[model samples]
Target: MRGADKLVSDSLATAKRIIDPDTPVLARFDSAFYSANVAKAVRAAGVHYSVTLPQNAAVKKAIAHIPAEAWRGINYPQAIYDDETGRWISDAQVAEIDFTAFSSKAQEEQLAGRLVVRRIPELNTTKLAAAQGQLFDTFRYHAFFTTVEQSVLDTVAADKVHRQHAVVEQVFADLKAGPLAHMPSGRFYANAAWLVIAAISHNLLRAAGSVAGGKLVNARTVSLRQKLVNIPARIAHRARKLILHLPTHWKWATAFDRLWHNTLSPPQLATP
Candidate 1:
């Protein structure tokens, strides 16, 4: 929390410089980054932010104020399949409240934002029974604090965009499974450099897949390596020409040929 303000501010400032000034930028973070300083930094950078808030007395109190009608059923972009239950689970609700935060701070430092909350009912036997036994239905709440104004974006739209952060998580998951399998060196700077190199390699592989222009465009790094990067080839030279022989009857031969021709041949210009 101490240096988070500076980190977020600097990152956002850099983003502002790199992107079109008129393009609206929104930063999204999970509960670990929930802090007044971070929110202030986001506001100062002229960017909107949506950060998950840890449940506390004030948050619970705010949830209590939301009317029953406010909660609207929303579908997950992709249905979550539960192996244990052998079913596709897709039931959740979302709502928002106009809330002011950091009240304890001086008037100048206090911030006003929306408390956007998503609640999933506890459907397990024990929790369901507990809910039936009590007057209230048991629910697990996931709420975020956002500075995005209602006029610019509504609650549903903001939540939808915030959920896009999961794509970043997928990239991290891919990295850990591939290039980041080992820390490489004991030195801090060496490991840091390795991480940077890993990211660059990952992007280069992704670009290669895109250039291949097929299912490989969305293929994982390991799959791309297996198909395109690691195939065995034998080289022979005769009459000042080199011939490379790949494995016969290869399954990915068409895709490999496409990649080869597309990469080796320059794009043809259209005649006017």
Candidate 2:
């Protein structure tokens, strides 16, 4: 754990060195990276951070202390599909309280931040005879710690932004599915070079997808490669001009044409 925290802090320090001081930066991390030291390191690097907090005793206590009236209801127009529960969540209650984390640590080490909590009703179907006719409602709580000021972002907005951290995981999944499936080399440096090339290829494919527009804008790397990069074509010379011929009746013909025109076409000048 200590080694991982040190690596995170070192990486943040390196980022701080290269990034412009004036540029606003925010780091979002999951529960695995949650720690007082990690938060402190983010602060030292001059960046704002939002980290998912584990539901420990202290956090649960703080959550329980929140008043009923403080909870504000929020709705997601497009229901978020939760993988763990296998349920589509459309609504939840959000509230925040000023809380200090890592109180067990020294006063200087403790970090003070807002504990933002979101709760959804726990509709447990199984019932016990002893627990029949429960007087209070049960809810499952999700919480995170953030240093973002209330004026900049309210509880709902903060929660939404924090959830977007999962998008980076999609990129990792794509890489693992494609070029990163195997190391392919015994030497460490050779494998490292391969990794770099894979990253470059991924970025280029993403750019091609964007240029193609329509559905390809957010297409996966593999799909992009199949539809655009690895097309079957023949190069022919006729009348002192080179012509590339693609397969007829291709399903992705329109998308391919859009990509070709956007990439190779000369820019049109504005008429005077």
- Model 2: pairs clashing at backbone N, Cα or C within 3 Å: none
RMSD of 1: 3.8
Model 1 poorest 10 in a row by lDDT: 80-89
Candidate lDDT (C-alpha), each: 0.84, 0.87
RMSD of each: 3.8, 3.9
lDDT of 1: 0.84
lDDT of 1 by residue, 1-272 (tens): 66998999999989999999999899998777787798889889988878888898889999999999999999887875544445576878899998777777888877889999988765566545545376767777878888888888788888777777767876887899887988988999999999999999999888888988779999988888999999999999989999989999998888888888888899889999
TM-score of 2: 0.78
Residue 175 CA displacement from its true place in model 1, Å: 2.0
Model 1 pairs in collision: none
> Model 2, which residues run further than 4 Å from truth?
14-24, 77-79, 121-138, 230-248, 266-272
* Worst 10 contiguous positions by lDDT, candidate 2: 123-132
